[model samples]
Target: MDSSENYRVVCERVAAAARHAGHEVTLLAVGKTQPASALRQLAALGQRAFGENYVQEALAKQRELAGLGLEWHMIGPLQSNKAREVAARFHWLQSLDRTKLVAALDRHRPADAVPLQVLIQVNIDDEASKSGCRPADIGALAEAVRAAPRLTLRGLMTIPAPHPDPRRREAAFARMRVLFDDLRRAHAGVDTLSMGMSDDFEAAIAHGATLVRLGSALFGPRR
Candidate 1:
């Protein structure tokens, strides 16, 4: 399908999933590796929420797609030096997995904007390559986040080891739910479990995910 048609189909599916999940599903068009023209087309399709893996790529889209008012999310691994730039631009940081990073985020938030929306990336599979905090450490980090002036401890996010099986994905999502609950008990106003992706997002929703980061499911497989 052409980009506009493809974007329409994806947006419809995403809205349906959101309603079905009883979640305020935020359709973060995972625009990684996608061209600015395609993204501009998609953005024209009433898509305001977008996620990009690389900081430079996101900035390019942000600049290219100017006046579209997209809410950009940094969904990939972030290094220390880039944190300041990211804090200055992106609306959401969905890949935060460590205390030091969290501290850096707090220190760097631009003073004028709303408290930045942040998510704690969880490495549910305990994989060395993936970015996320181990599930057990979230509570303490949430507390630390609460104290950060520039950040609003909005919720948790994760990239579990991918499993096509619905039940297994749900279990991983359920673990996220447990951690979410733990955070709420400790820090009030901590909501949103930003789990799930194209392959297993339905399972994540069934288990409780407020936001789903989708790429291929919406845009089709990236070549």
Candidate 2:
């Protein structure tokens, strides 16, 4: 299938999954390594929100397609040195896992621009190599984000330990849902739970993912 066909099929599947999960969900097209032309194709299909892992690459795309009015999201591990760039460039940052980065964003976000929407990435399974904070650190980080003047703490995001069993995947997503609910209780209007990706999005949706970040499932394998 071509990019458009892939996107159409992915959307249909996502709707089915969301219906099963009994909730509305946002589709964040993960366009990390894909080119701007690929993004333009998805944009033609009305896929407005795109997620990118790297700041410089996303910046280039943002410039190339400035006329399309796309909403860009930073969905990768962020460094303190790049916090300012991330704050200024993306509409949403889905990998906020620390307090120092939170402070840096708050200090550097453009005063004229809208507050940068943010998500607290939780390393749900506590993988040593993952970029998210541990479940124990979420509340503190969420609280800090809530207090940051230029950052809006939207909700929680997670990259669970990959598993072959659908039940195991659903279990991880279920844990994220519980944490999401707890976050919403403490912060008003905390709506986005960005969990899941190309491989396990359906399972993530089945467990109540408000946002599923997909790449190959939507754009096909990168060339």
Candidate 3:
């Protein structure tokens, strides 16, 4: 499928997933290595929110496409030094884990901008390589995020272990859901769960993800 045809199919799936989740879906086509034009094409296809994994790459896209009315999301591990620019530019952040990064985000939160929406990334896989706090650590972290006046604790985000066994994936997502529910119980304000990606978003939604971020599924294979 060309970009146009591919976009149609992707938009349908995104709409279905949004309906299934019973929440507003930010289809956030992940454009890590892809060019800004591809992202712009998707934005024309009605995808307003976009996610980028690399700071430099995402920053480039943001700079180039700033006129397109894009809502950029920092969906990868954000370095503490990058927090100021990330907080000032990106509207949503899904990979906030460390306290120092949070502090930096709060300190740099743009006074003229909207309260930055945040999702505490949960290390559901407990992997040594991933960039997230453990499911157990999310609660304490939530307290810290809520205290930041310029930051709004929307909910939780997680990257489950990419295992063949669906049960493992489900367990990881379920663990994140537990933390999501726990936090929601404590503060009714934190409502967004920025979970799921191309491979296992359905399971993430089944476990109660409010936002499912997709990339290849929407834009087709990256060039």
Candidate 4:
């Protein structure tokens, strides 16, 4: 399918999934390596939120597409050194996992801007290579974010180990749902549970994901 056709199909599938789950699910088009023109096309089609994994690339896109009034999400693991740029520029940060990052982001966030929205990325499967914090440490991280004057705690995000079996994937999503609920109960503004991706977003929604990040599924394979 071409980009327009792909967008239509993905929107249809997302609507169907949301209906099945009996909740509204927001879509964050993962525009990581795609050019600004592609994003402009989608923006014309009514997609305003875009997710980017790399800071520099996202920043460039933001500059080029500044007139479009797009909402940017930092969906990759963020290094402490890059916090200021992300804290000032992106609309959301979906990979926050440590207290030190919270402090850095808060301090660097522009005084004129509103509190930066953030989610705690949980390494649910405990993969050593991943950037998220362990499941057990969510409470502390949540507290730290809450204490930061420039950040707003917006619940959890997880990239579950890609188990080929649907049941195993569902199990991981279920665990994330429980964790999301626990976090919501403890924090007042914890609303977004950003789990799911191209292959597993439906399962993520069924198990309680308010937002899904899609890259190849929406834009075809990266160049």
> Evaluated with lDDT, which candidate comes out highest?
4
RMSD of each: 1.6, 1.0, 1.6, 0.8
What are the clash counts of all predictions, listed in order? Answer: 0, 0, 0, 0
Q: After superposition, how far is residue 100 of candidate 4 from its true place, in Å?
A: 0.5
**Top TM-score prediction, candidate number:** 4
Q: Rank the models by TM-score, top first.
A: 4, 2, 3, 1
Cα lDDT tens digits, model 2, 1-223, are 9988899899999999998888999999988789999999999999999999989999999999999989999999998999989988889999999888888999889999999999999999888989999888999998898888888989999999887877787888899999999989988979999988999988788787989999988877765
- Model 3 residue 117 CA deviation in Å: 0.6
- What ranges in model 3 sit over 4 Å off? 20-24
lDDT of 4 by residue, 8-103 (tens): 999999999999999999999999889989889889889999999999999999999998888999999899889999999998999998888888
Assess each prediction's global lDDT (C-alpha) against the native: 0.82, 0.90, 0.83, 0.93
Identify the runs in model 2 with alpha carbons over 4 angstroms from their true place. none
Task: Estimate, for each residue in 1-223, the C-alpha lDDT of model 3 and write its tens digit.
Answer: 8777877876677668667867666566789789999988877877788899988898899988888898888999988878988888899999988777778898898788889999899888889999999767877788888889999999888888789998889888887788888889998688888777888877777778888888887767767
lDDT of 1 by residue, 1-223 (tens): 8777767776677668778867777667898888888788777778788899999988888888888888988989989999997898999988887888877887788788887788888898798988888888887777777789889888888888766666776788888898888887877787778887888777777777888888886667885
Model 1 alpha-carbon drift over 4 Å, by segment: none
Query: Scored by Cα lDDT, where does model 4 land?
Result: 0.93
Which residue pairs collide, candidate 1?
none
